[model samples]
Target: MPFWLSWAVWSAPVKKLGARPAISSGCSGVTMLNWLTAQHLVGLPGMPTTVQGVNARAKREGWEAQLRLGRGGGQEYSFAVLPKETQTALLMREVAQQEPAPAQQLQQPGAAQVVNSPKRDAYTESRLNDDQRSVMAARMVLIREIERMSKVVSQQRAIDTLVGLARTGSLSPYLAERAERANDRKNADRALSERTLKRWLADYRKHGEIALAPARRKPNMSVPVWAADFLKHYQRPQKPSAQAAYLAFQREYPGAPSLHAVQRFLAKLSPQAREMGRMGPREAKALLPYNKRLTDHMWPNDVWVADGHKFDAEVINPNSGQIFRPEVTSIIDWATRRIVGFAINVAESTLATLDALHSGISRVGMFRVFYVDNGSGFANDTIREVVERLGGEMTHSLPYNSQARGVIERAHRTIMVRLAKDFDSYIGADMDGEAGNKVHRISRADLKKGSQPRHIPTLNEFYERLAIALDEYNHSPHRGLTKIRDSETGRFRHPSPMEAWRRAEAEGFAALQPSTELSMLLVRPQDLRRTHRGLVRTNGANYFLQDLVPLHGDQVRVAWDYRDASKVAVFTLDGDLIGQAILDGNASDAMPRIVKDQDRRVSGQLAKLVQKGKTLTGKDVELRVIERPAEDDRFQQHLLEAEKFVALAHEPEADALEAPDNEMTRYDRWQQLDSRQRLGEALSDDEARWHASYPNHPDFKSIQRMYDHFEAEQARA
Candidate 1:
């Protein structure tokens, strides 16, 4: 038998039995060259025997499986058994080669007409660069290309081609070059393995192009549940560290994320969120952008910023001769950066703020806006009313945001703090030492020790110095002010507050002339009572006004100048100005001089009486009574006679005096005898004669009896 026939016989059983070809245990697969050699078909002259030589020849000859099994390092691949039909076809083709074809058959018309598979058009490149395109978008493009190829070729064939390309790392020339540059040899050689291609194909079959992109890692919802509790514990004023918070989180959630994870999450938080845990809300809020308001285009009196700063230096109280720190209230013109007005008091009060505002408006003009902090003195209804009445609005800075009142705050630092440094009693924020040192600096011990009579200036002297300093400040060139040409000199110069005011006036932004009446409206009114004597009392002083005389016994509104108690403006309930009252005298005395003098004299007399040990008794009372004149004797006798006459007139009529029946004549004769005995003056002549004639007459007696009977009957009825 021929060697080919023997090789064919040896491979026939493996093909028929449907079993893998027998090979060495170390090498389960055979290369195309090795299989061809085993068949004893290698005797052709100049035919290469190596796998590389075979692969080159197979590639040129368009043999797919043979070329794939014969490429570089392909000799180690598992052998792919040919099908029985394929084996029979190979044998038949070999037999045909042995027998020459007839000329007629070879020359048959159109006998070699080629049948070619459909060729797909090359995929159009994407306009987006690799970096610009998302990984998922690129994958989608690739999936679309694969699907398009599947329409022209078999689905399995297309998938196998893609797998082969991926395994051989020949998907794209650019991608291969990029992999080479990155020195990723494994990835460059095998960009996507067969397993990866199969996974992608399976995904594409199931979910279309979306499946070509890598699946996202599922979000750990469980981690968020623990993280939420962690954040709640972490973001606090106490400001626990991430590790501390993680430990705390375990208490709330048994299975929390690790501390490292918590730290990474915290690091990803916003600046404000991170700051909020360490600092409080107020401080954290400061991290946000603020709307910076500028007053560049504003006129000199457009906005006035006001604030009260406690003076850092001690000054002697003139009245008490004691050293004390005073509070200074200052108002600054926002546009000009000028301290328009200021006031100093032993302490900050609404009165101090009012006075400062009043002075500012009086000197610089009415402002359009009053910017202030939420201080008790500046948040006053009186101050608000003052600003509103002046055709301005009052705006309060947000709590804890002092920057809103920057103008006045800066003024407090620039003017007051600078001035304070000149005094030995300076105790400002930047002062060197603690509270005790500051207290010792202002202590009265030095004065008690007769150390040069203590050098602290009196309040009045300090006020004078402050006034001079303010004048200098108003004239000094202001940094915030812009340069302006002097009208008189026609030369450019940096504008001071005074210069700014002058320039504003020249430019027709003249200030509104202050009205004293409007200013008085801002003065705080005190409900006070006026005495019937036309006196009003306040602040331990009695005030009197001629206009208040008629207003006595009425409740009046008294508004006084805080700086001076000499006079106060009094108004009625209806806001009618009654009159100004002058400080008359101390309210402690509260009495007319004459009355007070009398009381003093009475007190002195009582003191003298007590010194003499004099006491009142019955003998003293009898002596005092004996000093009076006695009553008249005649008057006593008249009183006794009148008493007896009154007793006789009231005596009841006796029953024996009444005579019955015809006893009328006897009664009439008795009446005549009683009348003659009682008569003080004699009757007229006619009366006397008639009485004598009818004295004992029976007719007279009968008439008298009838009258008596009529009287008795009338009385009974």
Candidate 2:
């Protein structure tokens, strides 16, 4: 008999023994599923596909029969009264016949699309520790020996023989060793028992050798309040040690954890939690989830990002002979990771940014959008005007957020930082401190000593080297560009920037070209200026031409080439082209004669109106000088006044009233006597007396020490 038929036959008699009485599901009418003909369930599992076979099985199984209520009424069996296996098969078949939800759909057992999930037991080996794996391996060894011996005798007899041999220590060396190791762990008998061997056989049959791996207990994860407090101190910006934090916690709480306990508690924290407070905001951002910008849909010239970087290596200025790092302004295409244009300047400035834009736009046409940072070099009205004139939009990244411009920042490191390492004057952050200092000292010392430093390359040399490096970078494989298969190598690899650009070009991508007028308009700096007569004053210089005379007093826009400041391109306020104006440094007057004449005429007209109001004048007056009496007459009056006055006066006797002089006489006498003594002449009595008493003065010792010091120095020299 077929397997399906045999299963139906064996299960029919048992199902019929406990058949329940028919029961209704209590609906208003019978559902089509409640009463199914044998033919309706014929093709299901464990049921014969033929109607007659299914009916015969139903009769043998005592399935309750019902009459169909609708058209084509006939005897049908109650689906709810069928055997359990038959009902299960019908449910599975019905489910398979219906449409499935996309996410939860599963393929049938024998279907072409069936895919089996990996079993949990497949990774059992990985979950076991070394000791557990060793024990499992030993047990597997003994099980294999028993299986091999079972082929030669009855299964029980084989098992008994193996147990006897293991107990007597008379089995083969490998078998005996495995038996001893399998029983080596806690609470095991000295030798393998019959029951233990049977249990091992059953486990091997069910879950394979993984079932024999020793069980392991999970670690305790509960945190005490004291440990939590210690963690607060340990996880700080200062990053205190476990012991130090423990000490701090002990100061606040007498029940603080021990140092070792703190360490163990810290070990249980997640990696991200362990870094809390210990890392800066920027550094800690590495643990955060970031938004990834997708550039797969972008074309080569769709977006360009511009940034300025100060080169790490010092280069000598060709004009000034001074060593300094130059700032490089670079514009990169977001799609291909290619540097379309770049400019090098002594420092970051708006001019450098404009030059870089000109270089890029002139080569590859205008980009759709200009992405840049808020640096002064790129955030000015001039840059905005240049971008707008080229039919592109300019956007600025958030302040202090370099991550938003990570592409260009990374490019700086890859291109400029790598190039710096090739030069001897590299002073990057990662350069050896001693070597960097030595390079700095040498360059400065050489300049101070009036000699050029040979170690520092000139600006021109640096520019040439940078050009070569950029070219190499564009042609070399870049990891940031999309990966593609090489035709020649027949292997998958990342495409170079140039290769990616060429691929884009091959796919019919073309750049938007700027018109000649627009090109010229965007390449120079422009401003609004009002003309005086035929002259327009801008940038501290006056520009003049014959064509500007008619529009002298009108406001106009003027664009001047930085490289050629002698002339400026003039246009009307409405953007109509006027004639070019040349610089007029030799214009004689600060104001033109026409403007001055107009001013004079306006002054005369105002004066005429004011003259009509008043015409009054006043007469002049004369004055005379006062004189005093002559000198003889004045002297005669003074003598008469002295004769009229009378007074009594007394003077002290000069020699007796005079006391000995102190400060001034001592110094003067000392100087005079000292000079005389040095000349080998005799001193006067008054000088001798003063000089003799001067040594007893309170300031003499300090003055003598100072004199001794001065004399010693003079003598030594």
Number of the predicted model whose TM-score against the real structure is largest: 2
Please write out the lDDT profile of model 1 over residues 1-717, one tens digit for every residue.
784354333322222222234322221111121133212322233334654665565445333121113333231211112223333333333322333222222211111111110111111112223432355455455555567888999766776776577557776875444323322122325254444445545655654443333222111111122333455677777877767877776676554545676676565444654555578757766776676776678988888888888888888654444568889888888888888878777777888887787767655667888888888888878777767777889998889888777767777777888998877667777777875384565467765553322556556657756866776687688777777787768998788887777777788887776655776566444565655567788887788888777766988888876655557778887778887777883345556556578878977876666655545432322112134333343344444443432232111111224222223444565566558747765755544444454434333434565577679978987
Query: lDDT of model 2 at residue 281?
Result: 81
- The residue ranges of model 1 lying beyond 4 angstroms of the native Cα positions read 1-226, 240-262, 321-323, 434-457, 476-495, 517-527, 546-551, 571-580, 585-717
Error of 2 at 329 (Å): 1.9
lDDT of 2 by residue, 240-286 (tens): 87788778876776544356666765675544556777888877778
Show pairs that collide, candidate 2.
Answer: none
Q: TM-score of model 1 relative to the true fold?
A: 0.47
